[model samples]
Target chain A: LAKTTQPISMDSYEGQEVNITCSHNNIATNDYITWYQQFPSQGPRFIIQGYKTKVTNEVASLFIPADRKSSTLSLPRVSLSDTAVYYCLVAGGSYIPTFGRGTSLIVHP
Target chain B: GAGVSQSPRYKVAKRGQDVALRCDPISGHVSLFWYQQALGQGPEFLTYFQNEAQLDKSGLPSDRFFAERPEGSVSTLKIQRTQQEDSAVYLCASSPPLAGASNEQFFGPGTRLTVL
Candidate 1:
């Protein structure tokens, strides 16, 4: 399992872009960076996933550096309703995926 | 037929009591998983099943925890002798588990168990 580290919390104003970065120094070659968002009392929802470079979806975008040691999740045009906990998981190998401590992004109006 | 569903959205149990949390994954999903999440912490994997066959259960905290997927569509996680520390949300997720592919797992709303 690749251990990941991310900020404990972050703040963003509505309409602004927020980027949360996660570091996984021991990430494997086949590992892909995936992000999930969790609101209180609910299970985490898939946000975006990427193997390399850039990947964008209707909800968010994922940017992976050339080294793959770290990746960033960029939420465009943040809103107060976007306040939630974000998790970054490096998934690969036959090992079951594990979610580590995630970053809490509070989008303020 | 719809998204994943879990029964008994909230469960309150006494110490040493037994509890069962159920999960209904999406139709024809080949992979099923159980997870336990403590307050203010990320969820931890508990066990996994592939097409009704138990695969990895090393994540189960102890013998008190048991899970089964008899029909490959629904799964149940039973915890015996519940302890106060067992108070947490129990989550279920499912995926296609396609070989040579990294599949996305859809998660259910989870059963919140409060061991009083």
Candidate 2:
């Protein structure tokens, strides 16, 4: 399993865009980057995933550079309700997913 | 269609008592996992089951913790002689068979256990 490093917390204002970056220097060739959002007392929900390049979904977008050692999760037009903890994981092939101390995003009014 | 579900959303156990937590995974999900989350910390993997087989249990903290998935659908995690350190939220997640790919895991609300 590859270890990931991300910001402990971030602050954003409503209607503003937010980007959280994760670093996985030991990422493997077969690994895929995934991001999850977790609300208070709730399970982590899948936000976006990508292997390389960019992948966009209805909720968020994921950008992966060519090296695949780092990935970014971009959330457009943040809202107060969007405040939550975000987790980034690198897993694939036979690797089991692991969650690190996620980045806590606080969307201020 | 229902997602994963767990019973007894909250449990308060006295020290030295035994407790059991139940999890009902999403229908047709082939992979089931158990995780323990302490307050102010990220979740930690506990065990995993592929169908009726327990593929990995190396994450289990101690021998006192046991988990079983008999029919490959519902699972039960039992803890014997609960201690204060056992107080945490137990999360259950299920995912479809990936066939060597990475799949999104659907999680339950988790069982909050407080040992007093």
Candidate 3:
């Protein structure tokens, strides 16, 4: 499993774009980047995933550079509801995964 | 329920007692997984089942923890002789297992187990 590195917390204002970056310097070639959002008392929800380059979904965007050494999760027009802990999943081969402490994004009014 | 469902949303167990938690995966999901989440920490993989077969259980902390997905849909996690450290949120996720691809996992609300 590829160990992930991310900030412990970040602050963002409402209607602003919030970006959280994750560093996986040793990410495997077969590995993919996935992001999950979790609020209090709720299971983490899948936000977006990407193998390389830029991938956009209805909720967020994931940008992975060519080397795949790092990736960024971009949330556009953030709202109070978007405040949650965001986890980056750097999956390796096989059936298991390693999840590290995610970056908690606090959206303030 | 349309999504993955876990019963007894909250469970408080005393030390040395046994506790059983249930999970119902999505209608057609072929893969199920169990995870343990400690306070302020990300979820840790506990086990994984492909249909009715338990493929990997290396993540389970000890033999005291047992999980079964007999029919491949509904599963149960039984923790015997619970300890204070057993207190945590147990999460269940299900997805379709594919070859050489990333299967997005759909998670349940989770069962918060507190052992006193």
The candidate maximizing DockQ is 2
**lDDT of candidate model 2 versus the reference:** 0.91
lDDT of 2 by residue, A29-80 (tens): 8888989999988888888889999999999999999999999999999999
Question: Candidate 1 lDDT, tens digit per residue, A34-54?
Answer: 899999999888888889999
User: RMSD to native for every prediction?
Assistant: 1.2, 1.0, 1.2
Which segments of candidate 2 are over 4 A away from where they belong? Answer: B99-101
| Runs off by more than 4 Å, candidate 3 | B97-101
lDDT of 1 by residue, B31-115 (tens): 9989999999999999989988998999999999999999888899999999999999999999875722156879999999999
For model 1 chain A, where is the 10-residue window of minimal lDDT?
A92-101
lDDT agreement with native, every candidate: 0.90, 0.91, 0.92
Tens digit per residue, CA lDDT, model 3, B1-116:
68999999999999999999999999878889999999999999999988899988999999999999999889999999999999999999998656222668899999999999
The stretch of ten residues in a row with the least summed lDDT in candidate 1 chain B is B96-105
The TM-scores, one per candidate, come to 0.97, 0.98, 0.97
Instruction: Using lDDT as the measure, name the better of candidate 1 and candidate 2.
Output: 2
Candidate 2 residue lDDT tens string, B1-116: 58999988999999999999999999899999899999978888899899989998988999999999999999999999999999999999999876232788898999999999
Task: Write model 3 residue lDDT over A1-109, tens digit each, in one string.
Answer: 7889999999999999999999999999889888999999999888888999999999999999999999999999999999999999888475576779999999999
- Candidate DockQ values, in order, are 0.61, 0.67, 0.64
lDDT of residue B36 for candidate 2: 95
Candidate 1: CAPRI quality band:
medium
